[model samples]
Target: MMKKNRLERNSNSYQKQSNVKEVWRRLRKNKGAMVGLVMLVIMAAVLIAAPLFVSYSSAVGQDFSLVLAKPSKEHIFGNDGYGRDIFARIIYGGRTSIGIALLATAASCIVGTILGAMAGYFGRTVDNVIMRSLDIFMSVPDILFTMAVVYALGASFFNLIVALTLAYFTNYVRLVRSEVLTLSEQDYVEASTAGGATSMRIILSHIIPNSIGVIIVNTTMNVAKIILYESTLSFLGLGMPSPQPEWGQMLSESREFMRNAPHLMIFPALAIVITACSINLVGDGLRDSLDPHLKS
Candidate 1:
């Protein structure tokens, strides 16, 4: 009986120490966030399931015979200037855009966490050098920096991801740095230090773990911004090369026939807007849920 009671007490203590359940409970109460999550799930499902039903050729294959064809029973969203199905292109394009954004944000988060944790934990010269260098990066406009990198590197999938990763990592560096500064001062951190734990171990094993909640919340919110940046680059002709179905590329191609066929612009624009908005909603919900200070 004593052993069982002790187990129960330990379980309750662990539950109190871990905010995972509490965060989820608060998140579920957010209607906009739930709706956004549903939208994201549907969007992702549609993107994944689409290729199973529609041939890949439909997205890139051109038949001038059907050029500028309006929506019909055969072509749901109608054919593009290249006589490709707009609907099919959008499904594939969404995968590309969202995929790129997710990869860039993830890369940024990893790089940023490492650097930020170092700066915060080491302090003094390490902090000065890291923070000063990041300040130089932050001076440039993200779009212009991304554009220049893409231009110099010559736009391709990998280059775009690299460019975006560089453009975004600074944000996380600052965010995580601030978070780590506080976490580093915690009693556990000092205890670990006094115990002669390696600086790297304490930063990685202790500081980062404590501050991960903030980093994750911020990373979630940054996705929408990265998506917009990618689409903008694609629109300006710096994105994926022609014949590849990117949303912005689709928009660029459709601009010529906007008066005659507005569906071209409408659908792709809607995809970007809806996807970004849904992500933002979920990000907002996460921020609220994780902060703990905010009341429902």
Candidate 2:
């Protein structure tokens, strides 16, 4: 009996590892995804390591004589309206925009997963209560909801994250709930129930683990959306406050200088686009890699 249980555990572990290996194998074959993966890795590394190489003062210090200077050896991306280094600001700005968006999306995913698991697995009153309560949030347009929250809370980093997370709540909840509905009916889930597992245990140890790939894919895609929203808020002057170099705010400040110094708008806009697109590409690849139906 002991030997049989050990073999069963080993088999489950091997199967899980094999699935992970297969996903990686498929991801490697996707050219666009691989490119996105590389770009994201390099960009994130640069943002995290930028402070080590460039002083923070370079991003904020003004140089009257160097204002609006074009890209050159002195400043690879040139000086902004305040004569601050564009490259340095971009590196740091990315840390705020991407970092906050990523964290908010992750928080949203966890919240949605928990609520979704309860609704989908339990059904009946539990389902109605969770789903109906969330409907109030879901009914509002996400952007407007986010705007309302940001407006009420005041537009700071923490408020932005809170707004984004709540605004994004519906997406993952609906997704995970639907997934759990189907997964709860699977044979392994039934087997676990027959073996006397608690509902929470089966949901946590079985359902949620199986649901991870889908949740992850959705979360990856949502990061781009959150970044865009953050930028929009910044552009509207409701994002990170002045003196805090966010890409959207950077673009906002460059409005009057479009004809005179197009570089001001161009660089920041590129950073937002490149970051969002890279994440999107990765999400697409992960979706294809993890879903057998999408395999080519």
Among the numbered candidates, top TM-score falls to: 2
Over 4 Å off, model 1:
1-13, 16-18
TM-score of each: 0.94, 0.96
Please provide, for model 2 over 1-296, each residue's C-alpha lDDT reduced to its tens digit, 9 standing for 90 to 100. Answer: 99999999999999999998999999999999999999999998899899898888999889999999999998999998899999998998999999889889988999999999999999999999999999899889888888899999999999999999998977888988999999999999999999999999999999899999999899999999999999998998889987888999999999999999999999999999999999999999999999978655
Global Cα lDDT for candidate 1: 0.92
- Look at candidate 1 and give me any clashing residue pairs: none
lDDT of model 2, residue 210: 90
- Weakest lDDT window of 10 consecutive positions for candidate 2: 287-296
Candidate 1, residue 193: Cα displacement in angstroms equals 1.1
Query: Model 2: what TM-score?
Result: 0.96
Once fitted onto the true fold, the runs of candidate 2 whose alpha carbons sit more than 4 angstroms away are: 294-296
TM-score of 1: 0.94
Residue clash pairs of candidate 2: none
